[model samples]
Target: MAMFVHLTAAANTPRIRRAGIRADSRGQGGVRGVYCFPVLPSYTLTHQWLRELARFGPKGALSAVHVRLDDAQEVLVGHYRDRAKDAQQWLTAAEAVARVAAQPDPRGWEVVVPRAIGTREVHRIRAVPQVAGWRYLPGAHGTRPCTCFGCRIRGEYGGRRLRERHPHPLDGPPPPVPVLLARIEAAGDPGDPAALRDALHWFGLRRRGPVDRLARLAAHPDPTVRRELVWAVQGWSTPGVAELLDALAEDPHPDVREAVADVRTL
Candidate 1:
């Protein structure tokens, strides 16, 4: 019986047989004349239509909907079993994703999606919607709404277990530098390295920022945070930043000292 299901799936599974679709991590698609956009794996139709499409006839084709987010460099993907199956349910779901992508300031969305394709696998996008007025909220980076199928499954696993498994918030936007710094300070013993890492990254994104407050963190006991500070201070020649780097050069950790000395020698 299991063999029968496996044998039948080959014919009914909506396999993408390489109609010339490619994408890099930066959401650049269409290496060939065929235009494509990045697809979010969780929204793909494979899971939704696996059983239904398999039970249908063998001539069905899989359809993919790619919604280009307002970032232009970002995209959301949705998949369907067949474009014309079950009163167009697959297409409806795909269009719903596009509508959400068009909304103003969508919140609690997944920044990273499940990866469904590999170098050996061929994935194709059949539809690209012209969505507009979509918003990207930086403050909402770490929160994913429970509506998504992936989130539903996760919810079944319970919150405490999930929190234990993933110490860092998996969904949501990058927090402001000040908020990140506050998180680091509040983290206390058995420190939250992730918070410190994010704080450093946030600091690096700005050309000018709170040098004094960040300078105070130079005294943080964690060598990792101090090392990140060293990296972030590079290129800035301000006296405070320079003095901080000099102090870091005397760090007990070899890695921290090395990072402080690694000023752009190029």
Candidate 2:
């Protein structure tokens, strides 16, 4: 037999003890299963998913259900992202344990049994420390975050604060033109490519702005900055924009000229 541990809300202990662990959908393609980690010699490895699972349960209180399955019982085992039917490999319960145990770091690996665990298969349920494992991803602590809109969930804990602090490039409202211009001006001599790109992005968003102050960026040494200028000036009703586009249309860089052609078509 192969030993595995299933983590769940502490509140579910009574029902689980009565009916055993019911199989649930793994959140994609109606494929139902019970997710577990093979009970390895290392306690931390056996319960590595506890902290991440706690986010979906009642606060951080969770119980570990120890289960015993026949070594030949077929199960799916792979990284969490490979849960799709075609991506995961079917391995026996014992093989799954060996695969995960051999890994130097298996934080995101999982085992999914296709059917409910019988009451006889469940050995015991015990409370575990709320802080037993990594969250977000293994070794994610101390890493800089990617605050793009697609990476953030609206109502998730601290999501609102994070979005406000680091607004998405394309989702949030653009800052006023004067603020962007000030940022460019504060960038000094050759100027910050990031600040210039930020200002240009706002032009793409607003599509219409005073171009007199921005006309100088067309001559910026960076072809990317000039290409962004081509994108920024498209569809603007402001004066001198036509002349600016005409100049960008003949830019030395083929990419900048291509951007100008693209803008003209739009």
Candidate 3:
């Protein structure tokens, strides 16, 4: 959403607005006159400007969302490699970018701060903005009545409500296993299939971005992930995916054999 600006010095013009002064370069008033690398504008400025422009332009219009980080104070990542809170900071920053920076304008974001891990595996859980499209909800400033997951669950269980959210927050947590599995069957790529698959075997719910994880599992060097992915695909496999799994029947791993057999039974 940005157009290149080319300005040449006419007579009294001494500075160019295209580039900014850097550490190596010197600036007199607002005019920067020095050669740091080779080009008039360094790559950093171009990248930074592009990011800035994207924030202000229509490209980020669809990314507007309200992310509420619930219990994001104790996320542990690379505990053995990195320190303890490294993953927590990374998760917090990522949520900020996805909710604020990635969007066209400033808006609220739902931040789910997970305190404990039920399993040992690394599940890079994130909260994606599920706000309605701009066409559907014009000038939405994240103050609309939400239907968050906590409300829905409490309603289903016929219990008292705990969180300040709607019964169906557009970006609530995720649905339960059976419900999520049903949703996956209905929509393969609609609500994040890969997330559903990963949660199916472990977390009991769908995740943020599971498609890439599912794809990686499908193409994993290990046999277990590939084999499990076959069943994962069974719930929502297209013809192309079936063909891909069919080719895997020739794998040397016996688990692949078992997985292919399960597919035929399905």
Candidate 4:
């Protein structure tokens, strides 16, 4: 999911042999992707788009820049040290290439198929973000997956839950308890750390009455259930919780105890 690619120690004085979004014509069933040739010596090209373009699959346009190596020599030497091959490498860099080179038709969008238009900045374009926060968002240094599948699922849960179920906002109440919980639980395993965290976080906000009955297992005897109970209870802002926290705050296990203490604070 991370595409901060081809920046080699040699890249300090990187000798950009060749870089661009391209379609390769070599294979029987060529794939398209963004490619960089003769990458910083010893540094392998792993960005999937490059390989995809090299095979001429659905690839973007070629837009890359070049540089001459100077102080970067030492950096390249060090980067490839781990690899068995220790040698010099380089590739070609071309400029002002085609973009299929044209403007697009707006009204014909759904009916007409499309080809990519190359941009001078094409090389810098990001992959289509598959999941929220899975991108190297602007202003961030290193890229990390900011959202897990569970988190995305939870957001979807929240969206559907908050939507108007009937013709008017007050036409009917929100979804029933069993229906709503089952929908959330269907998003993924409750045992998943992210899923559990989302479940506990959301239910606290809805605050459905007959609360314990609606969230039955939320107060079950099992330690896992107890942990979730503590997660939700700590967020309860109203009255009568001091007694509950008191019994839980000094519980046997550390995690449960911590959860109890957290609930007390809430």
Candidate 5:
């Protein structure tokens, strides 16, 4: 048999002890399964997901449910990123353990058993240190933080401090409307597509700006710049934006037209 551990809320201990770990859909495309890590000789690695899991539930402790499974049992195993369909692979339970053990750093490795683990397969349920594992992603500490709106969750622990510390170039919060307008003007005659895109994105975030000045971009040669303009003009309370959007509705570029269609639906 191969040993593995599943980290879960301590409150679930009684139910898990009675009925075992139930399989649930938690991954992309609703892949239903119990997630676990191979039990290695390293104690820290054996319970590396504890701290990460703690961030989800009500304030409480976490526990490690040790399990035993047949060596020949079929399972899916891969790095965290491999959860994507094209990258995932199937292996025997024993093969999963061996693959993870062979890695120099197994921080993001995981295994998914397609079925529930019956109470008979559980070895023991024990409390683990609340701080046993890396938070966010492995080796994330002491490195530059990604302040993108997608990566930084608002109101999460230390989130405000992190954004204040490492502001992302393009994904960070928008400047005032005047600053964005100055940036657009500085892009000059031919216009820098990237800088214009950045400024237009900032305008989109503000959602209300000088639409008359921005309307001139409808004839920009670059389809991408026009597409950004479409996104920026959505929901603006300013005058002439409706006429501007109607003109863009006839753009020859499919992407720009598609963006205008999307804005209309919003």
Candidate 6:
């Protein structure tokens, strides 16, 4: 936590001052002046110092500060009435401020202090630190563990494990065809590449189900979806499936065409 700083409103109170030198419009714009604030003695503006202050400060007194450090001069501060839940959010703001200050760039940048910090956002900031010349691992430097899609997949399929399989009784309830089809349709519609990939794999195991609805998605905008769809349709003896593969052979994406070629050979 930060060292507690004694703050007072009295104008006569002595305060510590830091000097900042900057250039101006004049030919000799290099002017310098002391900036004074009622901070505790011996406190320096650093990440560790800021973190400590944020840790001890009352939620009511802290807020998420967003600064577009660029020339646009856009600055926003988020103040949720409930500070208890928002303390971490404000700490993120403090960290961003310290990071920007450390950068040597003359141009400004943009950042937001979210009211609720998600794991994805946490992973993003750590993987790509705001300050220049710094690098760290996932969940490094006290950040939470990264469970982003890429990381999760790496964990699931890395090393000797080719894939995850759960064998079921041959006569068990037909693998919820309607539910899987619905999920596949939903994933194909604005089609996130990863979700579609998982859905396609689901199809691989239950290849005997009716796929007329799923096959309609053959013309999906994303070629990745089309490629996986082609893979899922393999081994079906239906003429419709063959037609689908034949049409995909002419897909604009070379990879999709290549997938169709491979499936044809099989």
Local distance difference test values of all predictions, in order = 0.43, 0.83, 0.35, 0.34, 0.85, 0.41
TM-score of each: 0.32, 0.61, 0.24, 0.26, 0.68, 0.34
Best candidate according to TM-score: 5
Q: Tens digit of lDDT per residue, candidate 2, span 1-266?
A: 99999999899999999999999746334558999999988898789899888656566479999999999999988888775566777899999999999988888898889999989999999998888888778888887556664555445788657756877768544687888778889977578887788778777756579889888888889899999988887878888999999998888999999998887886
Q: Rank candidates by lDDT, best first.
A: 5, 2, 1, 6, 3, 4
What would the per-residue lDDT of candidate 4 be over residues 1-266, giving only the tens digit for each residue? Answer: 11123211222122233333233222111223322222222222222223322222233332223222222221121111123343312211211011111213111000000111133323343233212111122223364323332322223333343343322222223346565466456655334454454455545544432344324444334456557656655545545445555666666767788777665564
lDDT, residue 155, model 2: 56
Model 2 Cα shift for residue 261 (angstroms): 33
lDDT of 1 by residue, 1-266 (tens): 00000112232234433322223222112111122322323333212223233233243443443323223222233222122332222122234346435645332222222223322334223431212112122242366523322332332325435544444343322356668668767866545666776677656644455667677667777778888887766755555876787788888999988887676453
Worst 10 residues of 6 by lDDT: 121-130
What is the clash tally of candidate 2? 0
Error of 3 at 173 (Å): 9.7
Model 6: lDDT to the true structure: 0.41
Tens digit of per-residue lDDT, candidate 3, span 100-188: 33444322111222331122211122122323223112243365433453322323322224233333334334455456546445544
Candidate 6 TM-score versus the reference? 0.34
**Could you give the candidate ranking by TM-score, starting with the highest?**
5, 2, 6, 1, 4, 3
Instruction: For residues 1-266, write the lDDT of model 6, one tens digit per residue.
Output: 11111221222122111111111111111212111111122223222222222223332232111112222222222221223433312223344444345545312222332222222221111111123211123114555333332322222323113222322233222247677777766774567777776666666555465667767667888888888888877766655787777888888999999998897887
